[model samples]
Target: MDKRGSRRKSAARKDGASRAAADEPQSRVKFWMRRLVIWGGALAVLVALFVGLAVVFAARSMPGYYQLKATQTAQTIVVRARDGTEIVELGPSYGKWLTSDEIPQVMKDAMISVEDRRYYSHFGIDPYGLVRAVYTAATGDRRVSATSTITQQLARNVFLNNNRSLDRKLREAVLAMALEAKFSKEQILELYLNKVYFGGGAYGVDSASRKFFSHPATELSTAEAAIIAGLVKAPSRYSPTADVNAAVGRASVVLRLMKEQGRIPADATVDPSAVKLKEEAGQNSVRYFTDWALPQLDLLLPETFEPIEVWTTLDVGMQRAATASIKSNTPDGAQGALVSMDRDGAVLALIGGTDYIQTNYNRATDARRQPGSSWKLFVYLAALEAGYTPDDRVVDTPVSINGWSPRNSSGRNVGEIDLRTAFAYSINTVAAQLGNEVGFGTVASMARRFGITTEINTYPSMVLGTNEVRLIDMTRAFAAVSAGGNSVEPYGILKVETTDGDLLYEHERNTRSTQLVPDYVAAGITDLLQTAVATGTGRAADIGRPVAGKTGTTSSNKDGYFVGFSSGITTGVWMGRDDNVRVGGLQGGTAPARAFAAYMRYAVKDRPVEQFDTDLQLPEWQLEPDDEYMLGDPEDYYFIDEQGNLIEPGTSDAPREDPFGDEFDRTLEGDRPRQPVPGQRPPQQPQQPPQPQQPPRGVDGAPQAIGDDFLNEATGARRDQRP
Candidate 1:
């Protein structure tokens, strides 16, 4: 009985230990579950805090939606003629602002199709599109790329610059979301449509329709709408009037996208990007004037400028006449430029080229071409200022300055002519001799006094117009002469004001005019230039009334110019080949003079005929042997030589008696002459090149030297010459 009881106790103990082992595993599982719950909850709280901070920071960093008030009141620059006639309205002046409902459904469909097909389906941000953009960027595929949605583009156009950066992208995304929250879907679409720009100065869908189809946006066909929609990326590149083929090709891309997005029916297509037009389009005259005046805006207004009215000095009639005259008077394959200004320096009309839409290269303001004999006006003016007059006589014989001798257009000198006669004839030898006498420095100073701002090289050839100048600047100088010696600055904008009549800026009429050329000197030059128009090379520019002008023809007839003026107006005309090719000896007396005369006839017909202020007559002198002054060598100045080394006076490079000192100094006795050997052809000393012979020493024992003028080419100002 005792053995059986002991065996039962052993079995009971083993069963109890097995039960405890199973329970321990369950407890371990429960502890792990509790720990995981605590840690995951903590992580969730941290993530929530991070996102909240980012949202708060982003909201604080960006401007509020209410701050975008500029977009609503934005007006374009409306340029008007001096007579208050409208030439062009530059910005959003093409069409009236329209609501989203006023826009055609097809127009909206085309924009959404080409710009953002998934605009309605996504929230403010599209993650799938962003991911695809990133993938495309990574794969270096440039063709299939996505950047901004319509909302983001709206934000950029309204409030931000189109700068590419990670920070800007983040800000754009945040602002887009904010815009969506503040406005309804229809309102956002309205803003986008009203703010987008189409080429040819058309802004918004309504204006774009009128620009392309010459009708309201409410009546757009699928083809017309698609063509306008394709211009959002680059308005100038695909403007229909500028390039029809390009516009049609880009419209095809939009049509295909519209079909793919199911915005339009599969069969509905812009097969040919054709539309009905209501008017003859492409206003080149307005474009030419606006392009000339665009850069002046920054100096006239602040960078954060309000849209304002720019009342310019342009005359609509004169502008049209100028363009017509230039095109008609010029040759078939040549180009022309013209600028006209009143006596007070107001730009009455300006035409840079025959067709501005075809090319915006402004020849009047930007082209730097040689002025030829037209520059002789300054050389004569300088002589008059130095006591020489129109009656003064110069021997127009063969002349050369250094090695550059200029020949007359006639290729022969008319010997011994008065200053007025020489000027009227455009005699090269007489002009060069006078330039050498009075010095190039004085001539350059006179040129500057007349309002030339370009660098002036004072080489004697400069009197023959080796220096380059712009047509506008040359007109400004002539206006100064016409204004009785008052210094004039060429100006286009007469006044700038807000559309509501608030004065932003106005050109003040300061009666205190600065005098550049003296009245007497101006009168003298006017007398000579008047003779030029009456009986000289510029005779082609002669109007019925009294007129003064100068004709300019560059080497080989690459460029031709005729600048003429009357009592109240000064005009300049330039005709040339774009590639600088020589044309049929196209002298200034030919096409340029004809254009100048034609424009001037219309420019002055409205005003009464009057002579220039010629009350002040000047005394004349004669160039005599006893009193004649000549110029010395140019190597006296430390000018850069062909080797790029400074050729200075008293240096070995300059011809001198002895570059290095002799073996015996002045303090020691001079060496006796060496005797030659009796036989073998008398030993010879090395032949020394001829040295610069100084004039007979003066009474003060210094060598007498002729005076030569040197000028600084960088400043267009004159400097005193070394004796």
Candidate 2:
């Protein structure tokens, strides 16, 4: 019996051991599973904390919902020329801020069909679309669509820049949720449709409609609405302006989507080939002026949500004339720019290039080419301010400062001549001598006082205009001279006002009347400039009016310039290759001066002819053979060689190769051809290569002592106080 009981106990123990072995495995499994669940919960809590911190950090600086809504409303800037002609509309132009009732149902259905099919049902964010996008992305689907609802897109367009990043996405989502909470479904849809970008700088459905169809958004047909709706995906790529075929294709896809969603009938279809696009007017070069004016507008009203109307100083007639002059007169394979302003610094007309479509580079305001002899105005003005008059005698011999020597353009220096003759002839040696005597620092300071904003290196070559300068800044200086020595700040924007006619900013014309150059000094420069235009290098610029102007030509004929003033209008023109390569036979006195004359004829036709304000009667001087020791080599004085390389005293007639070979050729940028009309050259030199002419010496310069009567009659001011 004991043996049987022990065997039963062993059997029971074995059965229990087998059951425990199975249970042991199950217990280990349960312990590991419990640990995994706890760890996962902790990880999830940590992740939640991290995400919460991120959200708090991002939301801390966000604008309040009301402020955001107010600031995000679509605002457009309508830029008008001085005479109230519409130039261009900057920023996203909206149409009347249409209400829900004013919006067309066909447009609404098209937008909802393409952008967000469930836009009405979703609460700012679409979970189903998000899941579908994620699933498709996971499955490597190439056609993965954005998960953002219409509200989210609206939030992004209004409040955020279109940069793809997690932070931006988060901000977009949070803003979208807030927008949904604050605005009703209809209001959100209205804002979305009104503020969405539709390509070619158009912002709203209405702007897109008017821009593409020449009709209001309220008149959009099913086909036009589909075409516009399709632009939302890739506006620039599928804009009708970019590719009509692609736009039609995208519209077909949108129509298919609408049909599949039961928004349109299955049989509803439009023939793509039958579509008619609006014929837009040929865009003009006024965009350059508008472009330059917009930045100034920002300074006047940096932050505003209200629509603005900017009255600019641009004159449409003058602008057209300036463009035509630059195009017809600028040599083939060269580009030109022009800037015209009145004495009060109101920019009347500005052409940044001959054709803005061919190249958008604003040479008038942006390019910093060597001003050539136009810069001499500053040097001579500085000299005049330093107790030198236009009648003062200066030797026009070759000048060497340190190792740099400047020779005259004519390659021959006349004997001692008065400052007026030197200026009218653009005698380089006298200018170099004057700059050194007055000190280049003083010269540069004088330039600053006259509104030259570019960096002026006080080097010897600077006197020769080797330093680069912008055309607008140079033109402003000339304008100051025309304004009777008053300083000028070139302004294109005259006033800024809300569309409701409330003025925000108006330029004070009186503020810029402060005297920058002394009246006596201004008269002296004007006398010289008038002499220059009357019988000097700028003779081509004479328009049978009382004009004071100067011509400028750089080395290798790479740049040509003419800046002058007639009546109260000051205009500057520049022509050159973008690459700074030598333009064969190009000269400031030829193409540039002619262009200036051509434009000024039109610009000043209606304006009254006015004389310059002068108070100094300059005494004429004539140089007689005093047999002064001649300076410079006699042989080098005969003629200017082919290339402008220095003619060393005893060098052969064969042109000396430049030590800086090919360096001058690579000075400027760009590879595309300049705005040049083929088979066209300088108007005057259409057949013959331009020849250097000795500047006319016909003006009275006989050093005759000015009688008090003549001085009193010619200049109303006292002769003793004259510069």
Candidate 3:
């Protein structure tokens, strides 16, 4: 009985120990669970605090975000002729900027339809859109849709750097949510419109409008608005300026989206006629001008603090006319240039070549071609300074210069002719002879003074334009003559200003020199050149107005030129093959002169009738006895001045004695008669003794006694002496 009781007690102890061990494990599990719950609650509180702080801080920084969102850099350039007419209009250089008011309703609807149909109804993150995007991404081979809301796009544009990473995406999400809370849906839409790029260097709606249609943003039609809105997805691929068909196709997609979203009424139809899509014309032309103007801007306002608006002196109508005339007149293989400037040297119109689309070589301002007889004006000016009149006698005979025989174009001498006729006919022989007599160095000096920025050869042939010159410089030189010899510097921009209307700088028309030629002399030269258009070689340049010009046809007819001026404008035209090959049967009088006339007809159609200033008048001139005859060897003839007075022989000092005076006659009598030497072989006259002569032969080869007897008996000499 005692043994049974002990076994029972041991069993009781074992059962009690097993129960205590099981309870200890349960107690340890409860303690760990309680600690875990406390830690989890603390972590939840910290996460909530961090999110709240981030949201508050972002809200506080909203103003800075808005400011950053609003700021943009834009590059815009406009080119105008001297008359304030636009040649080209370039849109901004950077991303576009548009105001909310300027965004068309159709454009707004189109963006919402294609990008985010439920943008207004959704919060920053749309669960339904996310699900749809995921489903589309999973089912389709390509990701064709996006779930990013308008607020997200704004957030990306404003605050996020472009990094495709999870951290960035998370930050974008957070910022987007914060932005949605800070700004209204309408504000987000406005920011989106103002910040998008529409391609072709156009940034916002305003720039796009001007780029495609040459109109303002506020004036966009529904079709145009739709086209621009569609470009947001892929600017370069869908740009109307780059690919019209693609742009039109994208626009159609946007229209369908609009219909699907009910942004357009069910019955409303998109009219194909409303789009009227055509390839944008003149945009490339404007870009060409902008490229040209940028370098000029940098040079003109190197230290400018603010953005500048360059108001050029270009006449759009005249520029178009010039461009069209060059294209129409120039042959297919040939290139040409046309430059027109006001009398004050302001550039009115400039056509660089047949097509700027093909090449950017600005022939008008860059090319240096032989001016041919166009340079005779400089030679004549030198003669005028030396005292030669337009009517002074010269023989257009074959002349040899350093083994080079300078011959007239016709290869036949026209015999004795006046300087005016010689210049009108572009007689090379006569011009060379005159150049030799006047000294080529003097002619070159005068040319430089008149703004010819080309190297001139100091040879007799230089008088026939052996040097190359630019069209712009030629136009400017002629403009100086039109301005009564006042030196004029060519200018395009008159002022530059910011879009906000702040004047950054202004250009003043500056005259470099006024002493190049006497006003009266310039006027007289202009009068003589008028005959070239009215009744001479340049008659083809006549345009029912008072025109004065000169024609130049170079050797082999390789280059043709016509440079002219009206009362208030000067223009120069050049036609030639870039390879310097001879144009088949082309002449300055035929092609270039006609182009000038055609352009001037349209350019001056609406301009007022104005004559060259009559205030600058030349003094009365009388022909000298020596000036009336071309007797001596061609090289022996001296250059006469405007008064038909010979520069006193052997004296370098500017001649003070008039060649027309009685004393000037005594200076001519010592060596030879005022008549042509007999037999084309000059007969040598007997030299008189230093003392008074006894009996002498008359200038006409008649024998007579000396003093009063010889003077009284020389009947032919007395008659010839009459002025």
Candidate 4:
């Protein structure tokens, strides 16, 4: 009886333990569920508070309504080349603003169908589209359609910034709501059409229509309206001026969308293959020229912001040629600028650099660099005006002014050379001598008279072109020499006119302009310039035509220049580094001269070939009898001994005896008597009496009288004298 009672008690204890274990697990699970519910509610409240604060912050930063309604773009400029071909359109262009009633119905329909399907139905934001976009984004799929309607786009374009952030989006949404409240749906559509950007610098529907189709917006057909509407999504991609085929395809997409929305007929279709785009010159390097000319327009029409057409003097063909030549010839790691103009100062082609897109600095008109030897134009002009002819004798020996010695580029000078030969070889000593003789002040004055508006230092080195002058100024000076001696102020803008054909200003010829250079002086300078190109330092610039230009290389080859003219067109080229670093082997005669030749060849291909007037009657010189300077190699004669005796050819110590034979030995003629040959000696000749030195012959070949100061004491050669 005791054993049975113990077993029943133990079984009851086990049953109690199992039931307790099961109930403990259920209790723990209930506790965790309660904690999860409490935390989730707290997180939901925090998110709501954060969103409320963000929306409040965005609403306060919105732009004013008055500012939104005002014109966004103040002005537009249409730059046209010389032949009426539009080069580029700068700044956003806003054409005639059309009201809701003036906008074509098809254009409105197309825009509405493509941009916002529920435009008339929605207040400002499309709730259905917004919901769809949010749902699609939540599902991890982007590429969702735009949720904002036409009102939203206009609000963003006119007032709000394009920052892709929550704050910007919220601000855009609030602005859209305000715009919809202030303007009706029709008015909103009109403002959107007129304010949105259609690429190629067009800002409004009318401007885009005129830019792409060359017609007004009201005249747009269904296809044209579709094309214009398609540009709203991606203006640069669909612009006809950029890519016509892509624009046509986009138009087809717009038409399909319009038909689906029941705005157009169900069977309505447009052929992409039949689309014809207006022909426009590709936006090219002409932008550099327009950039330079645009500022001048401001000076001519100050305080004016009206839409205007700028008629420039740029020759499209010549500009293209100049751009190509500069690009191909400019050395690596170097920059170049070019300016070409007619005799009357009409700028034909102005290239700021090799690639304008890479850099927009207008070196041609802006950079003031040392003109180098090309500045000798004034020094030589001063010489000619001082009554010194090209044939005047000047020795190319070493020269110094106040202890500053100028050396020739060759390091060896040819003594007793005429001015013509000295100028041809760019002999530095002669140029320095002439500049000093004529007075540096006179040279500077001559430079100013020829239109070098820069400050001219009357220092000795200034005559060698140390003064910094712009390429355009130097080219202008050359143009004065080429234009029959009248100075010209370089002008690029021919006229400024309103878009409606009202002329604001036109470049007028100054009939009362005085001659800066005398006719005879100009003709005389031409004689020297022609000889320089024919057989001198500027040989690389000769293009089988008469080209009279000068080459300039500054100290250490830092700057190289070639400026010349052909067929009444004067062009100047400059090559250098903006950082002022020296180029290894750059010289004016190398790249600059070649580039000049290349451009001139094409620029004057069709123009009539003309020659420079070089018929100036220059004074001639008769050679006075003197000991002839041997002009051949010393190796042609037998060697000499150390004791000053000639050695026979076959002797052992003959050929190797004297490295330089007696030909170069500097000794008096009578002191160093002539040696007889080893074989047979020629018969003796009678000595003639000394002849008196005759006066230099004038242009008429008559003996011209001169003063004692004009004669070189050593050579008895008459030097140039001031008149």
User: What is the TM-score of each predicted model, taking all chains together?
Assistant: 0.59, 0.58, 0.53, 0.54
TM-score: model 2 vs. ground truth: 0.58
Q: How much is 147 displaced in model 2, in angstroms?
A: 22
Clashing pairs in 4: none
lDDT of 1 by residue, 285-367 (tens): 65666777765877777543367788898998898889999989887677899999988878888888887756656788888
The digit string of per-residue lDDT tens for model 2 on 1-723 reads 999999999999999999999999899999999999999999999986876665565456556545643554556789898989887887765555667899998889989998899988886789899999999999999999878889899888787766688998887877776676666888888878877889767777788888888988888888999999999998756878657778889999888888999888888766654667787655688888986887776567756668899999999999999989999999999999999998888899998887754556688999999989988998999998777866566777877899889999879988666778788889899999999999999889988988888888999989888888999999999999998888888888889999889989988866536887777888989988988988789989999889999999999999999999998999999999999999998988999999999999999999898887655633333221111111112232222246633343345755554322364234212211232112212112113223222222223743322223233433555445655
Candidate maximizing TM-score? 1
What are the runs in model 4 whose C-alpha is more than 4 Å off? Answer: 1-68, 93-283, 617-723
The best-first sequence of candidates by TM-score reads: 1, 2, 4, 3
Note the clash tally of each candidate.
0, 6, 19, 0
**Candidate 1 whole-model C-alpha lDDT, 0 to 1:** 0.76
CA lDDT, every prediction? 0.76, 0.80, 0.72, 0.79
Error of 4 at 393 (Å): 0.9
Model 2 / residue 543 / CA error / Å: 0.9
lDDT, candidate 4, equals 0.79
Best by lDDT: 2
> Residues 1-723, candidate 3, lDDT per residue (tens digit)?
889999999999999999999999898999898888899889999986886677667777766546856565444655555455555555554434555666777778877888788888886777798887788888884855777777777777666654577887777777777777888787778877776667666766777777777776677776677788888788766866555677788888888788777888766766533565435434333333344445677666644333445787777777778878988998769998888888777777777778764555677888899888888888888887677666556777778988878877777897776667777778888888878888999999989998988787787778988799998888888888887778888877778777688776688757355767877678667766776777678989999888888998889989999999885789999999888999986788888999999998987788787665523344545332332242323222233556755443334565443323575355454323423222122223444324322234557876432333223223335434554
Of 2 and 4, the candidate ahead on TM-score is: 2
Ranking by lDDT: 2, 4, 1, 3
